[model samples]
Target: MMKRAEQKGVVENEAPQTSQKSKKQKTCSYGSVFGECDLHSSVDWGNLPHHVILRVFQFLPLVDRARASSVCRKWNEVFHIPDLWRRFEFELSQPATSYLKSTHPDLIQQIIKRHADHLQYVSFKVDSSTESAEAACNILSQLVNCSIKTLGLISTAKPSFMNVSKAHFASALTVVFVNSKSLSSIKIDDTPLDDPSLKVLVANNSDTLKLLKMSSCPHVSPAGILCVADQCHGLKELALNYYILSDELLLALSSEKHVDLEHLRIDVVSENPGQVEFHTIKKQSWDALVKHSPKVNIVMYFFLYEEEFDAFFREETPVTHLYFGRTVSKAMLGRIGMNCPRLIELVVCANGLQPLDDELIRIAERCKNLTAMGLGECEVTCRGFIEFVKMCGGRLTQLSIMEEVLIPDNDYSLDRLHLEVSKHLGRLWFPDMMPTW
Candidate 1:
């Protein structure tokens, strides 16, 4: 009987051992299915191919990418790849107001120290804070050795760059203009960019500059832009305020030595509309531009009162994209329908209570190539909008009409409007509704 008790005790001990082994086997089975296999323990993840690691790092944000470089020596090498630094945008914002986290100063220093020459397409995006603009300028000033190809200074809320001193901003920008002799595109809008800095840009980057957009630059006179047009013969796209757009500039762009311009945008804005007298571009100059570059798109944006519009659309103007920001009169839109035959897209932010039924129909008939339109703070009968849509048919690619713009007529109500519009559009269409909140 003692022997039998001993054997039973032995069986009990063995049973626990068997149960433990079963648990381990179960865990191993799960690991096999879920990629936690025993082999995973022995594999060296840090030994991944350089190209694979580089591609993964490319998708990471600046801060995260920098942290990821410390994972292994291979990743650190991938962090310094030239291709990864070719296109970079420095996002500058204040911590108090901006929801976005600013890029760490330490990382920016590391990039400037190690990869400044690798940068090609660089841009500075700053908020409304002048401090952020100052930070951007500091970085720009440090990129004296950079061979950047494309540079843009974009302000999110307001032109914070305008707050920077002209001397500080110009000196910082001159560093880039001097170093980046091959700059092909530049967009420095709403800044204190003066004539001397512009001349510096033309002197260094004229041979390679292709597109220049410096609208709302109050310090840059017409002569400054004329220098760009005269020297940068390869320029294909230009944008500037109306005050800087002169007959001489247009004629310079139309010269035989200059390349065919693809786009020209002019912003006509006045704080006190009637007080500012806008000079008109002569028909002869416009004709010369069209004769030289037949396919050029002349886009105009007008923000003026009703009386301030007398100088515009008077004759045959080649404006393709037109926008009226403030309240425009019916007579002005009538003039548009009569003169703007090459109109492709139009946006009218506000018009008076007049039902634009006749104007809508007229635009549809006259502007044959009109594909995109947005109307707001305006009145149009449902039937009139439907007729305009029918005339435009499926050719109207983008039709953004506010729901309030439509006044329900006896025939068509707002409830049934989308169905008719969708039928004509060959796709689903709905009027933009104002949010209740």
Candidate 2:
């Protein structure tokens, strides 16, 4: 009996040992599977050496390119490549603190150092009103030596900054035009700039300046613009909004030296319209201006009264591009169509008019090369759009039906519209209404 009990004990011990071995084998198998899986899935993508990655980064916008560089250490080095930020300026989301923390100041310094020689465009805005002008000037000073082709400045009003007599104001202007040898385009808004200062800047760089835009610059007068027209013979495009524009200035623009001006925009200041009264100009003046400057291609007259438009159209002149905002009627459009047979672009924003689609269609039919058309805020239906497109055939390249027509929900109408326009249309814009691409 004792021998049998001892044998039983030994058997039980062996069974437990076998069970332990099985558990150990299962654990090992799991570990091996996991190890192999990780080895296969884990990859060092950043370590891959290829110029394609840098090229891809170049294709991305400035902000995205910067983010991509922040992914890893090697990428950060790649972001510092001088050529990446040469053509564009980058602004970080955070204020100066975060920018200093994350990015190397040397990179920014290098950008500023090589400004005019390498940079093409710049967009800058300041967060604090009190600090805006000074901060903006500081940034501009850094690019003084840059051959910047385009500069856009946007700012807000603080009583402190509103006083233009401050030293910061002159400093900003000086820095902007200091060494802009190759500068061609400049746009400024809501800042204090006087006529004399503007003349000085234009006279300094008059040879290279091609396009100039000044908006809400209360101090700019017709005389200042004439200074530009007289000095900058190479000027091709000009947009002035909420400034003083007079018939005398228009007459100056018609001079032989400034006749090369192809695109012109003049927005009258409602409060100061008395300074440049549209109704006061004689019909003969308009005719003389057109006769003197036959090369003017695009003309925009904003906030003009109906009588002023009548005077303008009474003159027999050829207009290739015309935009009449708030003062055009169906009868006026028809008169314009009869006068300008070579009209290639027309923008009409006449509101509260009965459907003038019939007149528009007639104008489209007459203007054979009508490539772009903008019917702003006028009441028109999809049927009018269809007929207009049909009338233009393949000549219409850009069509903007803003604030009026409703695109159908189904694909049939959209498809038909697309089919009609696909042959010649390069861009079709409809506000708040998405038609199938």
Candidate 3:
């Protein structure tokens, strides 16, 4: 009986070894090269369809795609596909300052050599370093044969492109501007993009340019922006600083030859608070623009002191979106409620100790189109805020109120404020709680 038991144990161990061998063989069968791949095999990984491989490559980052291409000969071919290179963003950075991974120089060279013509939508993301900006400019200088359509030069932190030589930057940028005849969208904010370069850009891509966002560009004057408005009649969206906005530019855009504007963003930044006096647009010019492009959404951003707001919202402004980035007064808010009838969105970052109950009620009474609102370091009684929500009801798509902004009153407590606001908003709502840590 002991001998029988020993034989049974040996059989059990041998059975597991045979099963392990079968699994190993099955794994190896799918791991072979494409040349040895069999379509009839139960599972043939190397023989996946070309489109399938391309789809897989699309989801991978550039570096990982390069590594994955070396897995097999077929994958390497897919890596070089023109479709994969159509839209590429070159990330240029230095290790000392930026945490972003810089694109490998060799890969960039390879792309410029092999896939420059295939590029259509391209962007350069650089850190706050002159060296990285120089590298990006160098790459742009080499893309002489490319036909990029949409181009964006984004600074990860501060505007580092300002450190680059203006001549070098303009020359390199002119290469793409001159070559790409069908360029449509360009965003070159916070760069030393002067009026001369702006002329080159409009001279080349005037007919095809549709959207241009060039804000925080001190070098570009009102004449440069006016030139763009006059020449690029196909422009649908425009964004620039308030200093560059002129009544003549608005009149030029309002001409019959120009297409109806869709969106306009004006940044009212106060670098020198008391010294900077902003010019107001004539009401006739605004009326003409409204008559020409009645549906245009005018967005205004105010990053100025309380006194600096006197020039704005006094007249019947057509501003649809208004944002107050500094300490705004109750009088300013009251002015917005009275003048801005087309207001759709409002965000107030800071308000003094005065509560905005009357201003909120007036806005709810007048601005029928108000859909979104956000209040930060401001005071509003929980009862008043609830009343405002109730008056705006279901139409208020976005209501963002800070927890501290809403003071608990007799009718409303901290616990019940959200429940009341949610009922009127037709969605579950909660005040943004400040993080303890």
Candidate 4:
């Protein structure tokens, strides 16, 4: 009986070993060079429709896009497709010593050589370093057959970008401007673009140009901007500094040849340190602009010294979106309410000890289309805030007032405020609470 039981146990162990050996044989049938692989059984994402796959790839960042190209043989072919390479952005990092991943010049050259002809939209955004800017312009100069539709140059580092020479930047950019036949929109902030480059840009793409945003471009004079305004009749959007804006430029934009302009953005930055001086665009000019393009949105952004506010709202200004970078006074808020009748959005950084009771009420009364607002380190009574919300109604889509913005008055009540505001806002609303940090 013992011998018979031992024979049965041996049979059971042998059966399990045979099954394990067969599993290994099945896995090894794939014929991997080093080891077995399940290549035949894996999902084949490459079989997705070509257009659908390209659309999916469009949402990936440049780094991820490059990584995905190495996934498979079919994917490698799809990665080099011209359509997929049309719109590209170079997020060039700082130098290697600074511990940032800088773009390689050889990679830029390879792209220019291989895919320049297929390029339609391109932007060069560099960190605070001269080498990256050099690489950007170098890449630009080598775009031999490129016919990009939209070109944008941006600098993440504030002061270092100013270091690149205007001549070198312009020379390389002119190569692109002159080459492309159907350039439409451009954004070249903090670059040293001059009048000659403007002339070249307008000469080549006057008819096709629609949007131009060149803020902080000190080298380009009012005439340079005016030239663009006069020539580019199809231009719908423009952004420039205060110094570049003038009566002539406004009229040029509002001319009969030009279509009803859509948006005009002005950066009201103080040119000098501790300097309160500012150049004003007369109310008459603004009126003429409104007359020509009745629905034009005049957006003004103020980054100024406290004293510079005087020159801003002397008379009624047609400002739609207003932002005050410095501490704004109740006086300025009062002027904003009276003068900025067309204000659609207002962000006040600060108002002194006295509550902005009348100012807030007056703003709510005047600016009917006030959709979004933000208050930081400001003083306002709870009653005034409630009234403003009620008047503005649900149209106040994005009301971002900070916690300390509400001054403790007799009417201050967090629960009551929340209840009243939520009823009008169409959602639960409360003042932005102070951060623990």
- Tens digits of per-residue lDDT for model 3, 67-126: 555444565677788999999999999987888888766678778888899999999999
C-alpha TM-scores of all predictions: 0.87, 0.61, 0.89, 0.85
C-alpha lDDT of residue 377 in model 2: 58
lDDT tens string, model 1, 1-437?
12322222122212122243443443344343224745335544456688887776677666555544544445566777788899988888998987655665665776688779999999998999999999999999999789999999999878599999999999999999999899999999999999999999999999999989999899999999999999999999999999999889999999999999999999999988578898877888988999999999999999898888888888878889999899999899988998888899999999979999999899999999899999989999999999999999998999999999999989999989999999999999999999999
What is the RMSD of candidate 3?
10.6
Each prediction's whole-model lDDT (CA): 0.85, 0.58, 0.85, 0.77
Better of 1 and 3 by TM-score: 3
Q: After superposition, how far is residue 231 of candidate 2 from its true place, in Å?
A: 2.4
Candidate numbers sorted by TM-score from highest down: 3, 1, 4, 2
Rank the models by lDDT, top first: 3, 1, 4, 2
Kindly list the per-residue Cα lDDT of model 2 for residues 1-437, writing each as its tens digit. Answer: 12322222112212122243443343233333223423234434456464656776677654445444434445555555556655664332235523211222334554565434566677654443445445556666666566667877654333323544545675677766766656688877666777867766785788888888876676777788778877787787787763455566666667777636666665543433344545434455455556765566645555665544444455444557777657466677777766667678888766454676666777777778788887765655556666777778666766776544434434336546555455435345334453458
Clashing pairs in 3: none
Better of 1 and 4 by lDDT: 1
